[model samples]
Target: MSYDHISESLTLLQKDWSVDPILVDFMLGKRTDVTDHAVKVGQVIFHIPYITGEKKFILWKCYWPDCHNCCERQGRLPLTSDDLITIGKGLKYQKTSDFVKNETLVATWMESGPSGNNVLMTSVNLKRKIDETESDDGTHIRCRFLDEKGACSMHPNRPGVCYLYPFSSWLENETGRARVHSTYQFTGDCPGFFLEGSLDSMKETLKEYSNTIYDYTMKYTRTTREGFSLTSFV
Candidate 1:
């Protein structure tokens, strides 16, 4: 019933949104080198017709692929600037900038919104470090705190995003509130989470996690939209 350990195992996209047959094979245990390993989860991107509006969310095996392997193959885990700061402070790193370059940290900039005047929205991104010279290579950024074994060096102190992986939440256009769900188009999406009962057991917790991000995103979006204005530039 307690899949807390299991939930912490999932991670983000290794490559871009498009699926990779090779990685798929590796995950599916079809590759020669990775014959023993099998993909326990598949990712599903979908939009829900919520009362607020059509909201999008990605549903995947929150666990499996395991952080150990995920670290070796995937980019750094996504986190907000505040999360990174916490991680840096926990690691006792003097300058967070030293750990990661500005570019490595991906952000969503909403140049303009419905107001039509000018609304900017920034989204956080996860990245890793290959070394001092090679900080981030587009989508290949590595987490500086990732150990050789693919474990987060700064565990427990990680960001909310890290805590809520293989799952996500979004703002409903109708209600303008965050909504979370564990139900997804499970057809062939997540191989790791094959048992519905397992998922059912953790649905409540997953929902909670989903709303957490949703609320965070909503507040962030609201603050950014209200605080910044085009005139501020002039």
Candidate 2:
């Protein structure tokens, strides 16, 4: 009953956090070694709470059309100069692609799914791996994808932990134990996932992925905090 594979599947969000927070929850530690306890968690914004005159055109950039996700002055993702420094420390890039220009990128950005192929600009909306079947069939993670459709055709080549759908992540919890569940949510408003579960349930799933986000954030923070170069840091 473990979905750790998804955790590894996603490269983890390596970028810095915006004030809004991608926001997801998860069990920090393991309740049982072999249990689906080590699951992958994620959460995404599902449109902002408001959209007035100025706010509507705020360029609320977290993906999704009617999504205000979290309107930042510059962008939903708030990566500081240090974060850029850390990014350099962690990965190697020749010429900056959309990530550099956009400035708002996820630790595990993806670009594949059921709808042919279009770069998935955002992170995983919700995920909790548990196979289909009466037995709860392990745990099938439903990584955020097309609205009512399948996922990217090239989903296999997707980067970051996003590819790790239906998976769970392990984090340090208050009781000092990592747990597992079978639900997840998207950050911004999405049409695909808006049934069965309520907002609270979606929030819980998001929290799990958020923790995984922090876990991956460490890699860059460690390097950037040290004033490392892009070559060495990345």
Index of the highest-TM-score prediction? 1
Q: TM-score for model 1?
A: 0.46
**Over 4 Å off, model 2:** 1-64, 69-72, 75-203, 228-234
- lDDT of each model, Cα atoms only? 0.40, 0.29
lDDT of 2 at 203: 48
CA lDDT, candidate 2, residue 206: 53
The residue-by-residue lDDT of candidate 1 on 65-148, one tens digit each, is 343433443333445556657766775668877544542454433333223455433444544553323233223335566776
Q: Worst lDDT window (10 residues) for model 1? A: 35-44
TM-score of 2: 0.22
